[model samples]
Target: MVQELMLTLQALGLPRPVRGTLASQLVREFHGKVSELLPSLPPESMQPLLSSPLDASQWEALESLSQSLTEQYCCRRCLLLKRLDLTTSAFHWGDRAEGQGEAMKAVLFPIRGLLTPESDVSVAHVLAARADLSRLVPATSVAARQGTSCAINKVLMGDVPDRGGRPDALEAAMPAWQSRREDGGRGKAGPQRWGRRKKKKK
Candidate 1:
């Protein structure tokens, strides 16, 4: 298949490098479009379609499918962009209530059913919907912080004055740790003292 593409490109009088590059790009696009269409195709048709070389008619079909998909995506993108413009554009103070209504209709109302506590929708379904929505409208850094447990500013909890005179657990344990070390040192010295006493006895 690649050899055939290279030959076709070579017939166009393209240089070797250009032919190679163009062939690679064309093959990638063909594979990508085929992958997109494969899921929708019947299970029985998949093996034969993949195994055989695509004819002119088959190529035309793939090309048409790709074109239609591209058009649908562009239409969706335009709709989203227009909706975003409506959302962010300034409006009169008197129009705020109207704007909020519009926002609810445009955004919240679509997903209101999913948001209901009694809804039978699975968490995976809700998550998939959220994922699709997230792709359509990219999240901002501020939006990313929503539902996060961490605070924006760090507070020094230990630095606060201890009015109750209660020592921390670690601070209270320090004396015990020090006493153990002192005890170990005295035990070592007792062995030396016993050795000196034995020499005196001798």
Candidate 2:
């Protein structure tokens, strides 16, 4: 089912950015629909879907749903990181006054995602649930790494656990893009001077 969905979506040849946006939209829609339905449904009806003993087909469906959710969570994190890195690169080389404003905006989304509580539970608990499901459904391992990346991003973006009010704490916690910018990649100044220069005339 997952494969079929991916294939159908990919068939449209949507660019990566579009694909990601679509995925995010779908995820948000799914959450919204479930949230709406969950409350209205009686507890008796919910139990079978939530904790009932599943035979074969229902269990498979549950596994598929878990896999889809985890994968989308990871993809969203990656998209956020990618956007942050691009903004950081631009700010690093731009005028400080303008850069500061851009930097503030760039960090907002990831910070919100990191700090906001999901379902009133800690991220560790959420991850533990994913781990339990992974053990039961080995197929989840394929997408598990992406989920791990998202979890790590959350920690890195959040406040330092033991260190408080230290100026260097954030610098130390900076994402991989910081190092790349420092090393003269996209953030580097001046135009490329290589490639075939004017040929020495005979």
Candidate 3:
């Protein structure tokens, strides 16, 4: 069935992106319709239909089902929009900005702490502190080495322990990994090393 779909897509002679978008939309529509239909279908019929390669007639039925589902969705959405228009017709347009601002504030009030800054520290001071700390710290330490190895092991096993005050402590622990060279010097001797490369070229 997938092979047949691929062949049909290739026969269109469309560009790769166009063909890909068309294929994805068709698949999504088909799956959406199928999901709606699945609950009503018997267990006995489902296994055979799912396992077997669909014939031309079955594919046609699926296409028709998808078309019907899309039409129904469009009709429902149109009715909903009509109802919304009728409901909002009496609403005052002049106070929209103030009303919207109040509504947004009310919605965000519960989670304001998550959005707001935790400290009074300025950006410059924080950056200077970070630079000074980097200079004071050794190139490699026992804790850093342990953190690096622990990080790798945790990543493989999918069980990393969180650290206090630092979300990216494991990642930042590997100072040796940050530099291109093991000696902790700048990258290779070339013009490319001194400047940022074009994203497209990279």
Candidate 4:
């Protein structure tokens, strides 16, 4: 079923951005045939998923299957690392900023298939859940490494352990694993460079 879903989605060619389930990235491509698939997707069809037990193995399987499909049909590779290295897995998520004045600091993330249809959770709540994911991300990695930067301008995992202060210090010690980029890449950036160019006074 997973493979079929992957194949069908690939055939439709949706522009899925890089997403992480258990520290793995998805194949984000700029395909033009996404509309056709949307209609085909039956909303209720996903309900059966809730009944099935979702243990660690099940999650692992889902991750593996997605990774395989990403490599096969999407012309992409998949890899996993600790959640801490979110700077890498972060991709284009369409995180649009909301409101004006005092409410400007907070941003809104795109949530289409993420929330369960059974619930009536507010968008803020949904974004909060994602923020929770971000908080844990820092803790899941040990070795300092970069995976994928991101496209939605910035990478916010949505993990806010405390809607208060910067997440705990644990996230920094975690380790991360990810796929190598073409230029042997990294997701995040290094120290800011601020230097003036030489003037050409001819």
Ranking by lDDT: 2, 3, 1, 4
- Comparing 2 with 4 on lDDT, the higher-scoring candidate is 2
Clashes of 2: 0
What TM-scores do the predictions have? Answer: 0.22, 0.24, 0.23, 0.16
Where does the lowest 10-residue lDDT sum fall in candidate 3? Answer: 115-124
User: Which residue segments of model 4 deviate by more than 4 Å?
Assistant: 1-46, 76-202
lDDT of 3 by residue, 1-202 (tens): 5655665446543323453467567767556756776787655443321335668997778667666766676677667656755654445354775567666556545654343222223323322342224335543787676655654455455567855666655364544445445554665655545677678864
- lDDT agreement of model 1 with the native: 0.53
Error of 3 at 198 (Å): 99
Per-residue CA lDDT of candidate 2, range 1-202, in tens? 4654565446543323343466677566556656766777555443222333457887677667766776776677677667766875675565674647756766665665563212222323433352234335443476765555555455545555674767766455555543435664666765767777788899
Show where candidate 1 strays beyond 4 Å.
Answer: 1-52, 90-202
Which candidate leads in TM-score? 2
Cα error, residue 23 of model 3, in Å, equals 16
**Which regions of candidate 3 deviate over 4 angstroms?**
1-51, 93-202
Q: Give the TM-score of candidate 4.
A: 0.16
Candidate 2 Cα outliers beyond 4 Å, as residue runs: 1-51, 97-202
Q: Measured by TM-score, how close is model 1 to the native structure?
A: 0.22
Order of candidates by TM-score, top first? 2, 3, 1, 4
lDDT of 1 by residue, 84-141 (tens): 5566444423555665757645664466434322223332333234222334433445
Report residue 130 deviation for candidate 2 (angstroms). 15
Q: Pick the candidate with the highest lDDT.
A: 2
Which candidate, 2 or 4, would have the higher TM-score against the true structure?
2
